[model samples]
Target: MVLKTAIFFVISIAAFAVMFTTMAPLTGFLSYHDVPRIVKDNNEETNWFALTESLLWDIFLVLLFIVQHSMMATPTWRGLIYNLGLVVVERSFYIAATAWALQYIMQSWLVIPDYPLWIIDTSQSTPWWWFFTLIHVMAWIIIYGATFTMDLPELLGLKQCLYRDTAWEFALICTICLTARFTNKGIQ
Candidate 1:
């Protein structure tokens, strides 16, 4: 029992660390990563094959994340882990998988040769550029604010195992998970 608890903490910490670190580049908050390297580059050179390959790779990475998030969140998947006598650390496993997916996407994401579908102004001189930057930052604020409405430790797979450390029992309460909302384009 103690071993399982210890394992849960390690996994939770590692997974959360990976996910947290991976998010910056994926969300365009970092300017030095692979995704940013493509967008900010001014060169318009197009190697058709390389661009196609890069795009396919990116699509695969996105699909990988989407599938992992969707499937692992299912009741069936949770029940499988629960029935295997692993119910206590179920959320940790899910978080670990999510971290792996996000890490893989962030690391292996190739720069599309003919990329940056839309021109982005990184300069701070223009009003429109600043407005767009504010909008992006606002999106991040809104997302984090919404997430903080939940039990953050539990949501991040920490509180569940940590509950055993103390006498306190952890329960899934005061949490809102935004999932499965779809519009015309695709799942968002």
Candidate 2:
């Protein structure tokens, strides 16, 4: 059991790392410079900082997950969902803090001389991109919640191994949905 767990842990980390690293670069490749410049021009420096903070938090959480899984062997889906919840909470902090900081920066810097505060609002009516971002975030919450809930019964019953290959396959589908929603593109 220990060896199997160890193998699974190693494989999971490697797979996720490779996928994220590859996709991040690939996605950035198309709009690499433009993305940063847009953040700088349209958003405040603090907005950029929030993005960095969120990424750092994600890295920290990944490391936490690896350590916890390897040492504690938290195999149940409930545990995984709890960890995901932490990630979401951390991300929420990043988003809220970034939004607040951006508002302050805009108010003080007056970066766009002509564009008044009323013209650019960050509320729900903001933009489709913003709405989509929120939707994607909410989707994760639902995924984690359902996965966790389903696993609790399984764990209690000890009916099957907690995270079988099928769990990963399901996760992939959820990830695909998340990415498509975030990009405002339908699943292909």
Best by TM-score: 1
What tens-digit string does per-residue lDDT give for candidate 1 at 1-188? 68878887787788678767766766773333223333434575557787788888889988998999999989999889878966666777787788777777777877653466655555634776667768878888898789889998888778777885664332332222222244354566
Per-residue C-alpha lDDT of model 2 across residues 107-186, encoded as one tens digit per residue: 33312223222333334355755765566557656854675767442322221223443474576588887897878556
| TM, every model | 0.67, 0.22
CA deviation > 4 Å runs, candidate 2: 1-61, 74-125, 141-145, 148-151, 156-188
Native-to-model Cα distance after best TM-score fit, residue 14 in candidate 1, in Å: 3.1
| Candidate 1 Cα errors over 4 Å, as ranges | 29-47, 113-115, 122-125, 164-188
Clashes of 2: 0
What lDDT score is found at residue 56 in candidate 2?
Answer: 71
Query: How much lDDT does candidate 1 score?
Result: 0.70
lDDT of 1 at 111: 60
